[model samples]
Target: MKVEQIYTKCLAQGAYYIFSEGEAAIIDPLRETQPYIEKLEQDRAKLKYIFETHFHADFVSGHLDLSEKTGASIIYGPTAQPDFEAIIAEDNQIFEIGKIKIKVLHTPGHTLESATYLLIDENGKESAIFSGDTLFLGDVGRPDLAQKATNLTQEELAGMLYDSLYNKIIPLPDDITVYPAHGAGSACGKNMQKETIDTLGNQKRTNYALNQPDKEHFVVAVLDGLTPPPKYFGMNVSMNKKGYKSFHEVIKESYRALSPEQFENLATTESIVILDTREANVFKDGFIPNSINIGLKGSFAPWVGSILVNVQTPILLVCDKDTEREAITRLSRVGFDNVWGFLEDGIQSWKEAGKDLDKINRITAEEFAEEFTPDAVVVDVRKPSEYATEHVEGAYLKPLSDFEEWVKTVDKDKPFYIHCAGGYRSMIAASILKYNGITDFKEVDGGFGQIKKTKVPTTDFVCPSKL
Candidate 1:
C-alpha cells in the first residue's frame, strides 16, 4: 500500500493519492486536477476513484473534474447532494482499488455529509484514515459553518461531534496515521496544527478536542474561538455543489519576465491583477494603484485562495527580487498557474518606468496622540477579543474581517486612522481602504504595540484609565 499526501498550501488543503498495484485513488482533491493527472501519468497508475470528505465551504474541490476526465467514479457520504454523478458512500462500505481496501466511516459534525476513509493494506490491516475536516492534527472541525440554516444548533452538532470522535476515530489503532484535509490558516478548524500529518496517538495526547470527555465543555470550547468565515465562502460552497468550471485544456506557461511599462499597461487595462507580495509596511508605504495586497508574512496562500478565485486570471507579481520565486511557488500551491509575468526588478522597475505610485499615509504613535480628536475617527483592525482586551479610547472596533461592511458604517468624509496588534494588518486595512476609495486614512506606523511601547497617553474607552 503506497500513499502520498498532496498538500495545497494556498487553500491549506491536503489530498491523498493512494497507489497500489496499478490503480490510484484521490481523496479530497483541490479544484485544479492537473497536478494529480500529471502524478498519475508519471506513476503509470490508472485513476479509479475520487472522494470528497464533504461539500467544502472553504475552497472548491476537484472531484467532479477528475471524474469527468478519468472516467473514475466520484464518492461522497450519502447525505451529500453533489449535482454530478456520485456514489453515496455508506458506513463500512468496502471497495478495492489495486492492492488497497478502502472503507468509509460516517463522521458527521463538521457537516452533515462529512466522512473519514480508512485504508486497509492488501494484507487486511488498517493503514491510514483520511480524516478530512472531521479530525485535524491539533483541532477538530468547527460545527457552526454548516449549521447556519438547519434547526440543529452548534451545540447539537457538537454533541454529534463528541460521539463521532469518541466512537469512530478513537477506537482505531493508535498508529494509523490521521491525514486531515486542511491545516493551519484554514477556516474549517480553529487552532489547527501547523504540521500536515499526525498519528492518532499523538493527536489523542495533544489535541484538546480529543482530550475532553465532557461533551458540554468540548462543545463550548470549539465553538467559541471560530473566526468569521471569509466573504467568498458562500459562493464557493454553492459552486462546489454544482461543480466547478472546467479546467482549460491548454496550460499556459508561466511568464518568465515582464518590463515595467508592460506591467503598468496590464494593470491599467485590468487585463492582469497586480499582486504585491512585499512586506505589509512596504506595500503601505507605496504601491501601484488598484493592486491587491497579500503580504508574504503569514498564511499567504490561504488568504490569496480566499480572495482570488479565478485561477486563470493573469497575475503580475510585485515582490523584492529576492522573494520572487517564493511568491510564484506560493501561488502555485493554490493552483494559480496563469501567472502572466512578474515585474522586473520589482517596484524599482516601476520607478525606472516613471509610473505613478500611490502612498498610504502613516503616522507615529506620538503624532496620533496629539492629533486625536473625537471627530477624527480611529479604527482598530485587530481581532475582536484583542480589541476588547486593550484599545485606544473612543476608537471604533472594526476587525479586518469586518472591514468592508465596517467601512460603510463610518462616515466616509471623516479622516480615519487604523491600527492592529502590529503593523501587518494595519497595512492590509490601509490597502483595503485604498481600493475602496477611502484616501484620507492614516495607518499607525507601529500599530497598537508601538503605541503601548511608546507609553503614549491613551484613555480607556471600555474601562477607566489607570494613568
Candidate 2:
C-alpha cells in the first residue's frame, strides 16, 4: 500500500491519496480537483472512493466533484447530511483494496458527523489514522463552531471532545501515525502544531489536551482561548454540505483589460471592489482610492472570506506582476472566482497611465507621541490575545477582525491613530476605515514594535513569544 499526502498551502489543508494495487481512495479533497485527477491518471489507478471526514467550515471540500467525475462512491459517517449521492459509513465498516484495509471510526466532537479512518496493512497491523479535526498534533478542535444554535454549549462540546480524544483516539497504539485535515494557522483549532503529522504516542506524551487530568479541565482549557469564527464559516459549512459548486463548472468570464481612463470611470460609475494584494506598508503609503486591502502576507483567504459575501461581485486585481498567479489561485481556493483579470502591468501600469492615486497618512512612534493628546483616540488593531499582552497605554483595543463593530462605537469624526504589532495589520485596518469613508486617520509607521522600543509606561501581559 502507498500513501501520499497532498498539501494545499493556500487553504492550509491536506488531502490523502491511498493506493492499494491499482485502486485508489482520496480523503478530504479540496475544491480544486485537477491535481488529484492528474495524480490518478499518472499512477494508472482506478478511483474507487471519495471520503469526507466531515463538512468543512473553513473551506469547501471536493467530495461531490471527484465522485461525479470519476464515478467513485462518496462516503461519510452515518449522521452526515450531504446533499449529493453518498453512502453512510457505519462504525467498524471495513473495506479492502489491494494490500490495505480501511476501517471507519465515528468520532463526533468536532462535528456531529465527523469520522476518523484507520488504515491497516494486509497483515492486520494498524499503520495510520486519518483523525480529521477531532485531534491535532498539539491541540484539539475548538468546540464552538457547530454549537451556534444547538443545545450543546461550548462546555458540553468540549466535554464531548475530551471523550473523543481519551476514549476513542488515546487507546490507539502509541506508534500509530495520526494525520489531521488542518495544520498551523487554521482557525479550526487553536495552537495546532506546526508539524502536519505526529505519532499517537508523541501526542499523548506532549499534547496539552491529552495531558489534562480530567474531562472538565480539558473542556475549559480548549474552549478558553479560541478566537471567534470567521463570518463566512456558516456559509462555507452549508455550501459544503450542499456540495460545493465544481471548480470545472466555474465559467471563466472574459473581461477586457481596462485602460486607466476606463478603470477610473468604472470606479466612479458604481462601487467596484478593488483588492490590492501588495504588502500592507506599501498599500498604506499610497494606493487607489476605495480599495479594500487584503495583503498576501498571511491568511489572505480567511480574511477575504470574512469580508466578501457575493462571490460573483466583480473584483479588480492590484498586485505585482510576479504575484498574479498566486493572487488568483488564493482567491479561487475560497471560491472567489470572479476575478475580472488583473491590471495589464500591475500598479505600475496604472501609474504609467497617469491615473490619480491617494496617499494614507503615516507617522513614526516618536512623531505620534509629539502629536498625542487625550482627545486623540489611539486604536490597536491586533487580536484580543495580542492586546492582552503588551500594548500601548490608553489605546483602545479593536482587533482588525472585529474592526467593523469597533468602528461604530468610536466617534468617526475624532482624530484616530491605529497600529498593529507590526505595521501590516494597521494598514489593513486603515484601508477598511478609508473604504467606509472614515478619512481622518493615520497609521503608525513601525507599529507596536517601534513603540515598545521607546521608554513608555505600558502594561505588559504574558503571552507566547512566538506570536
| Model 2 whole-model lDDT (C-alpha atoms) | 0.80
* C-alpha local distance difference test of each model: 0.79, 0.80
Over 1-467, each residue of candidate 2 has an lDDT whose tens digit, in order, gives: 88888976656788999998899999998877888999899889989998888888888787877888999998897688777779999988987767788899988878878889999987899989998888887888888888974567888878877887888889999999999998987878877888998899999998889999998889878887788888777877877777555676543442336566666666654545888989876776668888888888777888888767555567787886677767776776666777766666667778887776777788888887777775667889887777877887788888887887776666767788899987877887888888787878888888888878765446766776444
TM-score of 1: 0.78
lDDT of 2 at 243: 57
Summing lDDT over every window of 10 consecutive residues in candidate 2, give the lowest-scoring window. Answer: 249-258
Measured with C-alpha atoms, the lDDT of residue 137 in candidate 2 is 77
Query: Residue 60 of model 2: what lDDT?
Result: 77
Tell me the alpha-carbon RMSD of every candidate: 5.3, 2.9
lDDT per residue, candidate 1, 1-467, as tens digits?
Answer: 67999886656889899998889999988766789999899999899999888888776677777888899999997588877778998888988998779999999998888899999999898979999889999899888777764569888988888888989999999999999999986878867888999899999999989988598888887787677776556656676788554544212345356798777777765557788888876786678987778888777766666556555667888888878766776665454666777888899878777788888888888788778765767788887767766787778888877776776666668777899887777787787778778888788988898887654445554541121
Give every collision pair in model 2.
Answer: none
Most accurate candidate by lDDT: 2
